[model samples]
Target: MEGNNDTVVTEFILLGLSHHPRAQAMLFGVFLVVYLVTLLGNGLMVVLIFVSPLLHNPMYFFLSNLSFLDIFYTTSSVPQMLVNCFSHQPTISFEGCIAQMYVGLFLGIAECFLLAVMAYDRLAAVCSPLHYTLIMSKRLCIQLATISWAAALLLTLIAVVLQPTRFCGHNVINHFSCELQAFLKIACSDTSLNDLLIMTNSIFVLIIPFCFILVTYGRISLAVMRIQSAKGRSKAFSTCGSHIVVVTVFYGSAMSMYLHPQGKISSDRGKMISLFYGAVTPMLNPLIYSLRNKDVKGAFWRLLGKKVSE
Candidate 1:
């Protein structure tokens, strides 16, 4: 059997969500529907924001970018998972696994920073209405978005490059896709450095932004309280309510999964919580924003009208 020195791992078996055939089929159906909704919802948001002239403000601009990132973030893992559900031999090459991990990490981190930037945009608009234009100019928005993407890419690159610890044990990943924690856990060599790096990155990427959002909202709340009319306060809170809900769900799930001691929680529970932030949250974002915001709804109608006219 040892012809030369070619010990190639052709593929890796993905120990997907379930082993039972019926369970796999059921799970596949559910994820297929979820994936479709995620695609359509995020896709529509991007298109509407892009084409609508009235939506050409800093807020909607950030929203469009968020939608785009959500699409990729969900797609990076969910489709692979859906495929694995039905595949008799659910496998991904080593290179493919690495690529998936990189994309997922990059987009997930980018979304965190982008959401924080969006909070700052809202704060400037609400707290300093008079100088909103001067403060959040198109150029400045572009700069902030650029920084978000650059930071995310840098973090992902470092993580991927440092993950050279050989996989000497079972090649089968327990989860559907190549998750960072799962991959690190299975490494044959010491992963203390990798763990430290991941923790450091998580602090800056997730914890810092979460704190920034909290402070920004606190200022916004004070500003809202100062408004003379109850209607004014209601309107201001309504404008922020959707973003607040999203921020809470995303950061709450993420922090619980990463910030705490993983040894305390069962592995299955951890995977389930990870699915909420990684898979479900992206699918829910556009629905929450569009359903709740009159501006976005109006833009949707306008876009629809233009399509009909065309």
Candidate 2:
């Protein structure tokens, strides 16, 4: 009994979004299209940001990185999920599951902090126009982006290391991807400690940054109000609106999924919410920014026109 085989589960079976045979067949096509769109949308956004000199600014710098994060964040699970759609028993290796969970969680947390950074960038641009350049230097922007990514890794790594040690029985994950909550449901040990660690860290990655963003926007609102020109006020809101829309979509579904009050958001609920937050939002981000932000639209047309000439 030195190493009991029963004490360890090598893999987990994920029950994807639907259980119906007919639905499963249909869902494969649906998710395939979604996955492709997520790639194309986020991918093109990243490429456009890099190539367009007009877009080479601190704000677009963060947006480009955000698009990159959305690309990888969606990629971390969607491909495997698409494959699972056709499988009889959608299974993932223990290590594969751990890696997937960490990647998704890391990108998600990074986005939270990055969005907050962008919020501050907007605040300085609107509230402190004279010092905007000094406040958001290239070096400072790079450092902020670097810190967001590094902090996410550090925070998610804590859960990644702690969660796997708790896995003992019931390896059936009730979701398409190897999500932390899905793992928690099947973990044989008492998951109160793991959940506590998760909630505690969620404060950093989810709640605190969101609060900071709200506060920044409050000051931004006041600053915009004091501007004499209607056009100037309109322009300020137009610029910040895109970010606000994206933040709403991303955090709305994420908070619904993770920060529920009942403490028992069913796995059935989990699958639907994950499909939205994980797959749908990434596809929407580029469209939101491109359609609303005048600069991105201008850059996109310039880039497209250049490409056509070639």
Candidate 3:
């Protein structure tokens, strides 16, 4: 990265969420807890789904994929965020910043697609109960998960390859991490192309998948209403309620941050939004599913009982 006035830009100073030492200490404790919970919660979900025969269906298959994604997704930035909270002047190497930016992008986009896939899985279970097993077979589940991950990889690669090589101005990033929008704000060179790429990527990774989820739930609602049994309708809604909450938090924050027109971004607002989606949402995902989902609770106790007996 070229620096202004012949100074080579080697790293960036992160102006983290708070400048006050007291506030930083408080935030450190808060985020440390959040990070640990994200890891343990999502990690347990993955292990439980893998080990429990009761969770071997397509729904839990997609869920396990989501669990893995949340684990990595939060890990990409939260560790650095925790470190920055204690540092008087937080800095990230140029290479490290770039790595954080793209890694988060990849995992975040994967979740967007994965959530859509989960919505489709719910539609099958509720709308086509008789054929749900046939429609969401093992092969189809693997293929869908593979495509979600592969597509995110390809999109992230394109964004990286097309990024402007010159970053000739300031090296101070005004956020906790090297967030995409915050990173873009620091580029001294013309970033019209980069801005365009972000918009296009947002459409594919955020907009389209969100729309798909909405339509899928629309179909799901109609199917549930058609069921004559109140018990059946209640069951159908229970199956989708957790997913609906997760999608709203994740996609709503992401779209607000990424889809806004250039120059409309507020520094403070962006940081808060990033914190919610990046840290808060990942931690909430496993909790939401486990609390709302009876099968997950059942499998957990069953595993606990087996270990206790052993």
Which candidate leads in TM-score? 3
| Residues 1-310 of candidate 3: C-alpha lDDT, one tens digit per residue | 5544645778989998647789889889989999999999999999999999999999999999999999999999989989999898999998999999999999999999999999999988998899989999999999999999999999999989877566664788889898989988878778898889999999999999999999999999998999999998888898899999999999999999999976798888998899988999999999999987888999999999999999
Per-candidate Cα RMSD to the true structure, in Å, reads 2.6, 2.0, 1.3
lDDT per residue, candidate 1, 31-137, as tens digits?
Answer: 88888998999999998888888889999999899999999998899989998888877899888988898899899899899999999998998899899999999
lDDT of 2: 0.83
Better of 2 and 3 by TM-score: 3
Question: Which candidate do you rate higher for lDDT, 1 or 3?
Answer: 3
Residue pairs of candidate 1 with colliding backbone atoms: none
| Regions of model 3 farther than 4 Å from truth | 3-5
Tens-digit per-residue lDDT, 1-310, candidate 2: 0135446678888888446768888888888888788788888888888998888888889988888999898889988987887788889998898889888988888888999999999998999999988999999999999999999889888876676454555778888898877777776566777788877877777788888988999899999999999999999998988888888887788877778632479878878888877888888888887887778778778988998999
Candidate number that wins on lDDT, 2 or 3: 3
lDDT of each: 0.85, 0.83, 0.91
**Runs with alpha carbons beyond 4 Å of true place in candidate 1:** 1-8, 261-265
Model 1 C-alpha lDDT versus the unseen true structure:
0.85
